[model samples]
Target: MNLKNLKGDVLELGTHKGGSTILFAKYLQNINDPRKIYAVDWFKGLPYSDEFGNTDEKKKAKGRLNDTSKEFVESKFKQFNVDDKIIVVDGLFEETLYEKLNDKVFSFVFIDCDLYKSAKFALEYIDNHLEKDGIVFLHDYSNFLNRPKYDWGIIKATDEYVREHKVQFTENPIAHFQKITSI
Candidate 1:
């Protein structure tokens, strides 16, 4: 994907440990694109539950994947030498997304929130802010790896969004949506 051709900035809805954020920063840096990558996350593990009644037993039983902090992610960015290319936004999607990004436009949105409600909110925000020809990369839209069983809300929410909005979608190993018009 040639991100240079895309317009506006980048928004990453989930930044666990900053792996994907670093990858985006490195790519933007290599292309000499000056657009900023906004990395949004709670830095805590998954929430207890969402509005759609989606829950993870592992999260309930063991508090899964909560070992990361915003400072830790920042350190990773600095270590990767792409600190200047990324901004870390700390908070839940419902609490901080609109407030922080209302004035910004995005040509690329990476959604890895992993829950129905989180993914739904992220997609709702993108519906208005994403620029024409923009791309939405949704993680866990398919059970490609046959990984441990988890909530399939991402799939349900995404499919519902696509059907309701009549948006253009590509059903690859990793499903994605291309915004062709502004709603």
Candidate 2:
């Protein structure tokens, strides 16, 4: 995956402090190519943590209302060294994604919405918005922990949908699902 010619739109379904977004954007910056990257989230906070686990509804609420400001998340990205190659789109997945971004075709999409409903929406949007042969990186493909996990909200929903749809899936140990499909 050289990604030198993968200069197309990118989407981030969830961006907590912009961790993985920085990874993608940092790579883009290193290559210095023209691409549009989007981070879709309210950025309030996560619904669950290592301490809270997935059972806590408050974690979900925090994820729903996580404190968000593009500048704030972007700043984090800058701290990680990828400022020039990222874009921030603040809003919910279903409500705002298609409204603002339906026209574009993405090359790579990362889904980390951390809620069942939102993750479903993110996967649906990526399925609709991505080009044929595009790649989708989904965080959390079915990791069982004795403690709660907030990210299951979207991942499990997406996992179920993907299985039902019979899309091809490849899992990475870092907890990402690589989906190769035509949208």
Candidate 3:
């Protein structure tokens, strides 16, 4: 999407410890945009299964990224003085997305959820809710292309979504899709 044309609210799918969320907040601050940032994440960490054949039951049980708490993330936002412009939703996307935010619309969505199914769901959901000319920045997409050490789930999900919907997309800094017309 055109940076000059960015409007309406922003969304983040995976807010791990609020690092990227902080940057998004700062970007909004620099632009003087008053729209709120809806940061969604499973602060309890991530879950894993045998679907990919590299199941880590122990890690899933212990909760990866569980070291960070929602309160800590909130504090980081407060420290940046962007807390007032954010709404933190702490839950699994599948359970919390439509249930808690079915009524909301977004001009920009940042997808960082590092899994196939989760990323797929986020893309589809954003496709339905994103306004015309809205943009989506998909993190972890390059892993399938340049990062050989990483898994391909995010890339697989993204490729499938774009192909199935016939959405135009770009990659590099991230996978960006600007909604211009129905395909």
Comparison by lDDT, 1 against 2, better one: 1
Instruction: Residues 85-112, candidate 2: write the lDDT tens digits.
Output: 7778776565678898888788788877
Candidate lDDT scores, in order, read 0.81, 0.66, 0.77
Query: Among all windows of ten consecutive residues in candidate 2, which has the lowest summed lDDT?
Result: 45-54
Query: Which regions in candidate 3 have their CA more than 4 angstroms from the true location?
Result: 3-6, 50-62, 143-149
**Tens-digit per-residue lDDT, 67-151, candidate 1:** 8999999999999999999989999889888898888889989998777777888888888888888889988766556654345
* Lowest-sum lDDT 10-residue window in model 1: 53-62
Report the candidate with higher lDDT, 1 versus 3: 1
Which is the winner by TM-score between candidate 1 and candidate 2? 1
User: What is the TM-score of candidate 1?
Assistant: 0.87
Q: Estimated TM-score per prediction?
A: 0.87, 0.75, 0.86
Which candidate wins on TM-score?
Answer: 1
Top lDDT prediction, candidate number: 1
Q: Compared with the true structure, what per-residue lDDT tens digits does model 3 show for residues 43-156?
A: 877654313323364224335667777899999999999898899998888888899988887888899876776787888788778877788888866644566534536667
